[model samples]
Target: MNSIGLLIEFNDGRVKEANFGMATAARGENRNLVALVADGPAEDAQAVLEAYGVARIVNIRSGNRSWDPARQAAAVAAAMQKLEIDSLIGLTSPSGRELLPRIAARLGAPLIMDCIDIDLEAHRVRTSQYSGKTIATIALTGSHFIYGMRANVVPALKEPAEAEIIDFSFDGYQDTGYEVIETRTDGSGAHYLAEADIIISGGRGLKRAENFKLLFDCARHMNASVGASRVAVDNGWVPYAMQVGQTGVKVNPKVYMAVGISGSVQHFAGMKTARMIIAINTDENAAIMANCDYFAVGDLFEILPELEKALAAAKRSKEVA
Candidate 1:
């Protein structure tokens, strides 16, 4: 049996739902699964990790509550060595994108990021390559391997298991000589596009930057993240961080809504894994119309307002009921 470790990501003291998917992918009948949390609430993490097949949770208490990449990497490496973990898996989300490589470098392990599929025994991975034009199968050969799986593709199936927290401070972990003084975002927290359950993306159809308010208004009712196509970002309609395509960020949300998008190959490659896709476009011949699960042909300006109001009414009615 392989000693497998899962990096637990938390937001606001709550376990991110995406971590469950990672756990599910790492667990099997012959695997030993453990959760490694760094500077987060171990008790809260254990509660969720335990429900999803984790055998134990290790809390890396660095005592300093600052964002230290090097120190965090050392702590995780220490745990990996002490626990005899041959492989570690995490999400391809923001933190995973940043932390996994650091840990891999520290541990001298081969790192694979944004992998679509994994086979632990063979140490093989299937990941997108050539800007989503090809799916490459990689065979890793090293003392250890770290994989970052894209969110949502792996189902978060629960198989109840025992969870116990172990407090671990690395034997010899030093600071990375840097600290985060301040962090600023676009005010959307825990609603990242790549990690969102539902994403509403706008394209050239938005017409103006201010028109995003319509999408935002709808998103407020649905609690969804906003995404944009390359054209929208090129036109300065939205920031690059919100771009969703092969050249941008890959997503695997449960439901993806494409508004005013023509469904370019790059854009489709990014969200093709989405379970459900809804498209709203005026052009009947738009590629999105054919590829989407549901298509609505109409003027977005007219359809969006009615959709938003109807959603609001539905939410209110549900709450009242």
Candidate 2:
């Protein structure tokens, strides 16, 4: 069997539980190993890896909340070399993108990033490209395949096992001279677009920035995060953080409510993975309506308030119950 290694992150210890889901897909016909990169939440990392049936857990300590990607890359590359790993899987966060490439380069391996699906047949691993919009499956010809997995795309599995913890230290690991000058957490406790369960998006039809309060009201009622089309974000109706599309964040929310969006293909690139989509727009022929699970054909200016009232009433009744 091939051996696969997972580079783990412990953020507030909450994400340690997430590793089991990630490891499960790679474990069939593969020996699973997890390396816990200690920044925060180390204990959580140990628990998650053990639950995932990891054969070994390597722990490395770093004191900084903002970890250096290059250092992480070097550490992972060294571990891969030492263990003779056949395949390596990392999470597709900003840090993962930065680290995995360098690690792949060090190992002389082929690197695939943001892979939504993977097929391991014999010695070949096949992957789809262009974020699932356009399909091109390629098989790896190299001895080792390195990849970054999109969060929640793979089903996590749980197996009972005792995780063997091992400590590993990197000596003379030079800092890449990049220091985090400042840091501020979002405090919302919501994950980014790629990880959100529900997304409420606005678009060009919203007309003005001040009108976006209506969008926010609807999102609050639905208990969802806010997102925007590129046009809306460029128009300054919403913050750049809320933008969703090719130029913005990619989201796979369970329910995506798009208000006033015309849905350009670039915008669709970001949200096409949503489980259920609802569009509110006057244009029945809008591209968004075509892909939506349900569409309300009407002027959003007239429809938003009614929806907000109905959602509010439902919330009130639930609270009463």
CA lDDT, every prediction? 0.88, 0.74
Error at 136, model 1, angstroms: 2.0
Clashing pairs in 2: 21-156
TM-score of 1: 0.94
Mark the regions of model 2 whose C-alpha exceeds 4 Å error after superposition. Answer: 16-18, 62-65, 120-132, 175-177, 184-190, 221-223, 309-321
What is candidate 2's lDDT per residue for 18-106, written digit by digit as tens? 45556877777546566545444545566656777777776654434466666667776776666677687777765676878888887
List the lowest-lDDT window of 10 residues for candidate 2: 120-129
**Over all chains combined, what TM-score does candidate 2 have?**
0.86
Q: What is the per-residue lDDT of model 1 for residues 1-321, given as tens digits with 9 covering 90 to 100?
A: 777999889887899989898888898768989899988889877767889989888888755677776678778888898888989998888889878998899889998998989999999999888777789999999999999998877888998999877889865865557777777766756378898998999999999899988999999998899999999999998889889998788888889999999999989988887899999999989988998899999999999999899989999999999
- Give residue 159's error in model 1 in angstroms: 1.7
Q: Supply candidate 2's per-residue lDDT for 209.
A: 96
- What RMSD does each model have against the real structure? 1.8, 2.9
Q: 240, model 2: CA deviation in Å?
A: 2.4
